[model samples]
Target chain A: MKLTTLAKTVAAAAIAMPLMTAAASAYELVIPTLDYRTGAYAPNGIPFANGFTDYLTLLNNRDGGINGVMIKHVACETAYNTKQGVECYENTKNTEPSGALVYQPLSTGITYQLIPKSAVDKIPVFSMGYGRTSAANGTVFPWIFNFPATYWDQATVFVQYIGDKEGGMDKLKGKKIALVYHNSAYGKEPIRTLQKMSAKYGFSLLLLPVDHPGQEQKATWLQIRRERPDWTLMWGWGVMNQVAIKEAASIRYPMDHFIGVWWSGSENDVEPAGMAANGYLSGAFHAPGDKFPLHDEIKKYVYDKNQGTGERERIGEVLYNRGLVAAVWTVEAIRKAMEIHGTKEVRGEQVRDGFEALDVSEARLKELGLPGFTYAVKITCANHQGPGKVALQQWNAKAKQWKIVTKFYEPLSDITGPLIAEDSAQYAKENGITPRSCN
Target chain B: MSPDFLFFLEIIVSGLMAGVMYSLVALGFVLIFKASGIFNFAQGVLCLFAALALYDFIAPGGWVDRWFGFTLPVWLGIIMTAGVMVIVAWLIERLVLRYLVNQAPIILFMATIGLAYVLEGMGDILFGSDVKPLDIGLPQGASDYMLDTFGLYVEKLEIVAAFVAAALVAVLAVFFQKTRIGRALRAVADDHQAALSVGISLRTIWVIVWSVAGIVAMVAGIMWGSKSGVQFSLSLIALKALPVLILGGFTSVPGAIIGGLIIGVGEKLAEIYVGPLFGGAIENWFAYMLALAFLLVRPQGLFGEKIIERV
Candidate 1:
């Protein structure tokens, strides 16, 4: 019995040893990726996860980690579920020594859940372009960062583009615009902003909500046929995007007049509808396709070395590039963090400081091999969201590529700014958070 | 006709067409349940897998093209996918159903749920988790002829799907009525012990029944994958079949068709006419509510055979 107990003790130690080793590896900067590679959203999630992981792998393979510090990428699958996302955060947050530097869940639902938790844990939740639009108010949401743009910002950009097409903002008057969206928190995000915009611009706003998975949209499309809205904007993800596009095409809804948010603009969404999806416009922050200098570098460092995460051909697809951009921001923030503290080993709290002070200028973007990709971003304590600029991209089915049809333009901040302040103030009051003074 | 009347007619026509698509999936469920008394929960996953296989076989730069150096024509790829589904059916009968033979019906149902997860995983592993556009040369977009002549819009693909579903039902009806194998399957379903006494092989019948069900899944997959790209969510389409089964009865083939039509029209009308009163998106739960009402009135379903169990 004593021998058996000794043997059991030895086995327990063997299992615990590796975990202890992992915890002790504090010298290596740990970045936890909450990824989804299965379930309904897997088609969209896989490419983004691949791009994110591949970029981090590129940093390790090409540059020997971020500033000679070996990066430990710990990936946890959330399956695009909010519950699973919270579970992943709870499980991976405290990895011993120095906890995870940052978390980019790439999901709006997950981002919403983590807003409060990040403040307590001192772990920065970088939602990038998706999350609570009110979280863009940095004073209220100190740990939550949705840089470059928010959903509200994107909504304004889409409306601005529509106005430009009709000659000017004044032309939007009396025009009926329908918002066909997924009936979820993520889908309902742009409604308040669009409503405010409609009230200001005199365009009648039509709300059409399609439930989750969004396969059966026959009823929704038939209504669109009856109503005959002038413009239709979709805020959808995964199969919802594809089905909506197909339904829109079947109704002979002029594809040019229909626009989707960035989440709906992936190749997966348009490819299903074939030539019918041609001329479908969508709001975008970055250029599409794998033609950038960063692509060449990724091919050399990641693909050639067989350390790639996804198919070689699908390197610069929209979602993949979104992931690459996410990884680029993360690494750039870590660099800033290191420079600020003058230390290689930085904790999650220090990373939050890094996020606030981040400034990716145009020259800096050129230096990073991604010139003219996206607008230059500068994150401050007062504004977690950077310049909320967006561009319009059109799908060319024959060429099978997305082309940026317009120059990068700014969102209507006059309306969005006040809306953000009002929404964030309400959120702060409800959550019992004393708004921090950025000054 | 008045414009409003024309629009109402358009809604009904569209609903019937959409109903045909739902019936196509519900048909697969009736086949498995009627033959084996097992609710095949993996039917939707089977559809997803079959579609993924068809895409991999036919698509340029697909698995067949990458590995074998040849791309299959659409028709040939479908035939090959049918063959693959038959093999999967045989494997399921041999490995899963055969072992659980004579077990409780719930046991068989649970096995299918397991089969679903396994098949979903296998599909992702084999085909990769990328959504692929499937084009089997079926007509898509608005039917210009109908739109111009009737002043009503109808999708060409949905029309094609309606025809395909009708043809499939006719073929299935004939197979069940005329074939000797069909008689054996019915006999096995009625009394397993009695069928065994009559020299019928339960295993063989199960394999054949599953194979037929699988082919039906392939058809449903093709139609749906053509509408929306074949992806992981294709499996979730099974949820749409539940209300159909409840209203139509789980064991009746014709019942699936009628149930699909009622649910389709009822939900569409509710969503369009009544949904706005309650803020829209009521179609998602409208069918389930109708199914619940049906259960209180007629539990055995509209076409289901009422079993008289003697005490």
Candidate 2:
């Protein structure tokens, strides 16, 4: 029995040693994407997932796999459920050939639970747009990276946009602003930021939350009508977007004054309302409409090759472009990680470093066929977010397209940073987690 | 408080429209329950499926495009949707619901739940995961002719909805009170065994009732699909009819409409005046609470006849 136990251990070590050696030489990186391909959010989720998958395929086909090391990605559908997302995380953490370098769980609820697990597993989570706003502080969340912007960042940009439109910040004083948000962690992430800004700007912030599977909002909008808010910031998802627009239009609320979060702006949302969505503006991380050079290349190389991820026509829609940009960010992070590690076989720790070390400048973005798109992103020990700058786009009736009007603006970091630290500290203390030492 | 008062009136009007939609859905539920003595939980999914079918028919490069070599117009597509609903109703009667005719209501209800999952899966596979706007050519602009003194701005669609709902209810009422099939349906609803013994074919009654319910579901689907666009989330809206059914009694037609209006208006007022005192979004739980409270008081609902079973 002892001999057999020893032999089994030896065999296991022998099997593992060669694979480890092969991993070092081969330079293979594996990324697990938690996708919601079939659920209430599936309409938006599927296109994004497809764009993400297509970009990796494009890299493999065009660049010969990120400096000759093939990039592998496996998508496990979460349907936007937290339990299923966590299960997918546990199932794909350690697999053959490589360990998971990073995980991007799109759902904020799942991200909250995975933040602690990421520390124990040494795998960083890339919550590009959706997750805990408090995790923007790298000091508290060492293993989590919420790059580009957090929900708070988006909220600040939105409030600033409203202020600018209404003449100045002073004009916002005494003006009522309604926040009609989804009743979930993802939806509520912006409330604290809005509250802070409301206090500073002297705007009366009215809170309205719509329940999940948000189809019925007659009551919520009725409240909006009562408040007679000058502007409304909608943080809705899926069917809620269309419902909100319709209800607002029904009550004769000016659709132009109603702004939505990034998630709320999509072809699906506007197409339902048709001309009713003419003046509605939304906060955007990536430019929408299928006119970008990268999208043109995708159409030529990918869709023309009959290897397209979805309907060829939907290539440049809001959600599709967002997906493609998300993929580009993921790949860029991998490339940075590989560059620092001096090898292609980058592990989870290396990927985390890659995320932290990401320096995608305007030149780099232009080189990648994404010009006038985004700014330089730098993640540090203290700041997980690189920079929060979002452009405002409006739906044009004559052109039948989304036109960007406002240039990028930075979020209220001075207020948001302290709030993030305070919340993160509270979270750590409650969960018995020790704050990571950056020094 | 002028704006607040105006908002209050607006909520009541919109809430009444919402009630119309819920009643249309509840009409289907009551039809099935009266005929088969079984609650069809799958009714909600059926509404979603029908709406999705209508969207696909009108959408560019859809089945109509493949089959007919071109996209059909919206009105024609709607006609095709009606045809599709009929076929689906026939199929349901032939395949699953027919077999469970003599089963206990609990078993039949469970079967409907299973059917709901099946329909939801089929919808996802058939339509692809994308929300499509339901375009029914309904007037979308708000009515400028408002009673300025009362702070009321009624939408043209709301007025159309009220007229259409009233017309449908009146038509159905007259049909049931005057038509031969309507009489047979009522007879069957009262005692299926006795109706069968008296030479009323149970199969015919089941098929007819299901077909009528299918048509009712399509009307509900069209109104809602036009409002929110035809997305999978419409199924959840269909589920709101359950509370309507509880308040109105599963066998009452007028009760369904009146109960839907009361629930809708009540929830809206509650959320506005009372919801903030605790927290916002009280509308989510208010419907269920109202239904539970009503059940405790009336037991058999506003219109349901009391059934005293002998031990």
Candidate 3:
């Protein structure tokens, strides 16, 4: 009996030995990026994916890995379509190297569809600029995180910027402001926020919708010509931005009075208009141009070695920087996760904890060479967007660059907090989501 | 009540102008269909290409930036654009449409779809994917001088577009009725085999018809592109013309104009007065629904020849 028991113990030890060794050896964190490398939006998508991949590569090459855990990233191209993005999410959800913490869909449409699924799968979705703005309320949407800013935050800042430009908030009392937007959920996101503000500010709001892909806007512009609105807020994407700018210019509308969201502002948006795009302003979450140290490092480490993803000149443009910033936030979240879990090897849940605990301070931003880029943001039990601020940048004709004019912060707690809560409750009721109690 | 009445009138007039724009695109499709019995799916892309070419020529500090030193004047750029369209027409006929002339209508239609991609790629390569302001030197600020008491304010661009379209239609009517080439075109369109037997070269007629279509597309491009800027998405306006073609006959110019007007005005009025009750954005689908309803009632469209198959 003793001899038989000894033999069984030996067999068990042989089976368990390799796994323990494997666990102690170098571990890997597999991150799956759902990228759109081709399609109607490839102009924006390709560069963003390139930046994302390059940043991951940068972490591997420069710092060896995130907290010594090498990241194994696999990119599945979705081509900016929602169905393909979901398919990619499903295919890469449980990929080897175990912890697939975050998924950035890069499309609001896809983000909306994935929100419920992500929550069920226990994987967090990071929809930075575009998504259901109410998803910013983390209490109901525990798995969805739209850090830095929400559409409502952007709308509030846009109004605040207009108020600032007019010298005071009182100047907005009787002005006619037009919201020329693409007729999609992403386009209509700021409507409720803008309408609410307009009601309070006593400004007239004209809602104008340009259909998807926004090529033909003669009727919309004709309305603009008819109404003669004092200011126009553009919520557009891809070719839509250029069309709006051109139409506004053709009508001889003051370009300075026209404002676009961050997605609406890019080198592609103005390159077509050239001189005609002068004085057009857009609210930006990050500054344009690649003057940041991280950019310089990318140039030195990546581009210099011909390891860059895009053309050398396009390395630090607005969209490219935004992509890099998105990567930074992601990696920082991972770092935070490692800090809390007391080990480099963490699961998707631990990564979520990290995101919730992120405290990106001004000092840390400056250290990262993203000075004046963003304020200190902290995600909490109820707030997923964190402290949001936007800067207004105008296209200068002489300098041929976007110059930051001023920064505006919305009254988040007073305005957005209640709205988010109410919206989350409504959304929870509709989606049959049970809100988590913080206590 | 007066404000609502005024708003209604404004919507109707504006919608009519939009209809004219749609008619211009529908006219290109009609021209191609009349000559070749194949719908030119690339007509919208052709419009976009022409407009982008014109804008690029005039925009300062571009590919030809050093040639003119600064910006080329509007008239010169427009003339150059016309020359470019003629070349594009020749190339398209020689390289694509000519080869598929004897193929099925579906095959020919698919060829135009291929041509659309080629043109889009070439356009993006040549002009880049940026939106450029199309400054065609049309009069501006006319909308401000409103006949307020009559509840009417006319935009100068709209006035210009109406006149240009009317003039083009008149010119085309005269060309088709008065010119010998026009007679040959009509003959070829009527009976291809008979026209070929009569010693009229189908190739020459095809080239001429496509050239004319190209010119019309350029004019339409300028009007629409100037209003909305020349971009890739500008080609989607062609979809708007599909319902116009269904409403009108595929071979009738007057049908195109009238059909465009009906669809445009109908959708606008429905949206303004009836839309809010149902939901806004009804205008987006109303045009197609109206056309579909019309097709159910009149399969040959308002002017299309009724096909009577005898098995």
Candidate 4:
């Protein structure tokens, strides 16, 4: 055991040698990834970490590192633990010329921890789609970003999808919609938005929270069975997702009406349930499958060169693709930062500006070879979440794939707008930060 | 008949079924604690390690396929897994536990906790962190007859787990009652010095007892892993059976069983009936609270040996 510890110490030092030296350099843009590759969340987390790291490698190999300057990416494993995630942040936050370009704390709890720290350090924390939804109001949360769609945006869009199917929004009146959420800050993020929407649509909403590491949810599911809700939308992660799907199947619930947030929809979540989890729909920003043009690029340049990160096959899984999307945005923000600052090497603060001004148009999507894969994303000075949009996808059991089956649902900023303003304003007031207008 | 009453009945029935597996896990802790005065904290993680090994044996994943070249059949795979567990038990005794013998019981207990961390890390390295489905052709899904007949709505797997737990208990009972080694174990449990003098080697008994616990842990791993997935959380849930240990009593086998059922049933009912008033998810701590309350009243547990230290 001592030998093993010594070996691990030597191995860690060997891995850290580059970053330690790289911190003194001034040429490359260093993005330190506080990722969870080893712990309870690793099964779901490994692919995301792999995809994130692989994208950086792919850029270095295929494009000679995000234009001329190489992208130096370092990962410190947090094991999906908040303390370790924060520790990773503090340890790796210092990288060369200015500071670590940006930190993406994938776990929401870790993201929450880093929010104030990043603002203080002037380092942007990109939470992608699963952090505090109120962070969308860029006026208040200038350093924090949860772009594309927040959990609130997801709830409303899910309602829209259900409305689209049932003729219209008015048709949802008096309908019972259950939200089986994982009981956490991440899980509870959607309730307020959902409650507001439920009132507007006249739909009855049931909130059933499954505690952390949700393995024993027999009682929760049994409640679902008795209530017989018209639709059940799950906000779950890890083992909770798989268990919920299986329990839903066992209760003979119609798989079509039972939808889950993107996190709840993955190969890991559904494959175990086999045919029972068929037709289980979920909201997604990016399509699943490795058939994308960039995947071919990733395959040829990355895996073919034997520079891949994880199982060669899991390159385009739901979360893996989400990781790819996250990396693309992070790099895109840096590029915008470079363009705005008119310099090859930009610091952490400049990257925040780049993120605000960054836009992924339909033409740009075509240029990036991700056309029709996702919608044109645009971030403004005031709205950090961009055009918060997500489409629906369903699990095809026979083929074992997540196939996007709907066009992007427009985000209902009308409901989410006021909530964000109120929440962000409250946050700003509590923190004693004079809000930026950005006009 | 009101639907509420029927649903209540359903909850209780399902809770008992879930409790059966908890009893299986608690049973392992009981066996080890009864024979040796050490609280084996790694009993939970043993479930995880055993399950992972069983999965690797049954389904030779990428790493196994690279070297071994073939997957063992289910029955054969189980035997191989049991063999691996026996080696693990032997190693634990020879390496760690052997050194701690005659030390304070609390010291021995703390050593097992340390062992759990070491074994957890080892488990992660050996069997990667990915969640593997432990489908050894174990029955899953709801029982059609139960669902159709009385709206009982019980999982087929839970029923299988209950029967498996019952069979394990019966076998364990016969082993301790009739077998010479079992007699040796009981003799050691009564008084280590007296048993040592009667031609029973203490080292051999410790190894045997730990091996039995390991086998019990292996069975639990299969039962629970097949229900959920063979992942880190399996070990974590296995730890949850701790509350069952206190309720059942440290030295009582039958106590573990009854305590497991009471806690399981109690918690499920609490979550279903009382959870809503408190905003739900009461099941998580409900069992521990019940155990804590029960322990206050009956310190010896449901069937625990009375602790009467002679002055």
Best by TM-score: 1
Chain A only: TM-score per candidate:
0.94, 0.92, 0.92, 0.93
lDDT of 1 by residue, A1-439 (tens): 7999999999999999999998666488889999999999998998899889988898889898999887889999999999999999999999755689999988888998998899999999999888898888999999989989988999998898889889999999999999999899999999999999999999999999999989989999999999999999999999999999999999889999999999999999999999999999998999888988999999999999988989899999999999999999999999999999999889999999999999999999899999989989999998998998888899999999999998888888997899999999999999898999999
As for model 3, its CA RMSD to the true structure in angstroms is 7.8
- Tens digits of per-residue lDDT for model 2 on A269-295? 777777778888888877877766787
Q: Is candidate 2 or candidate 3 better by TM-score?
A: 2
lDDT for B52 (candidate 4): 90
Tens-digit lDDT string for candidate 3 (A1-439): 6999999999999999998898666678878898865445666676777778778877887877797778888899896788999999999988776657799898899999999898878888999978998888888998889978888888888888778778888899999999988788899998988888898888999888777776655557656766899889998887778778877876677999999988888876765565768999898777778877888888887788888877778887777877888888988898998999898887788888889989888888897778877667788877788777777788876666887787556644556666787888999999887889866
List each candidate's DockQ score: 0.76, 0.62, 0.20, 0.62
Instruction: Judge candidate 3 against the unseen true structure and give its global Cα lDDT, from 0 to 1.
Output: 0.81
lDDT of 2 at A154: 91
Cα distance off (Å), candidate 2, residue A254 = 2.7
| Model 1 per-residue lDDT at A284 | 90
Clashing pairs in 4: B248-B255
Docking class of 3: incorrect
Flag regions of model 2 displaced more than 4 Å: A1-28, B1-7, B66-69, B73-75, B147-150
Best by lDDT: 1
The sequence of per-residue lDDT tens digits that candidate 4 reaches over residues A183-285 is 9999999899989999999999999999989888889988998999999999998989888998999999999999999998889888878789999999899
Using DockQ as the measure, what is the rank order of every candidate, best first? 1, 2, 4, 3
The per-prediction i-RMS, to one decimal, reads: 0.8, 1.8, 4.1, 1.0
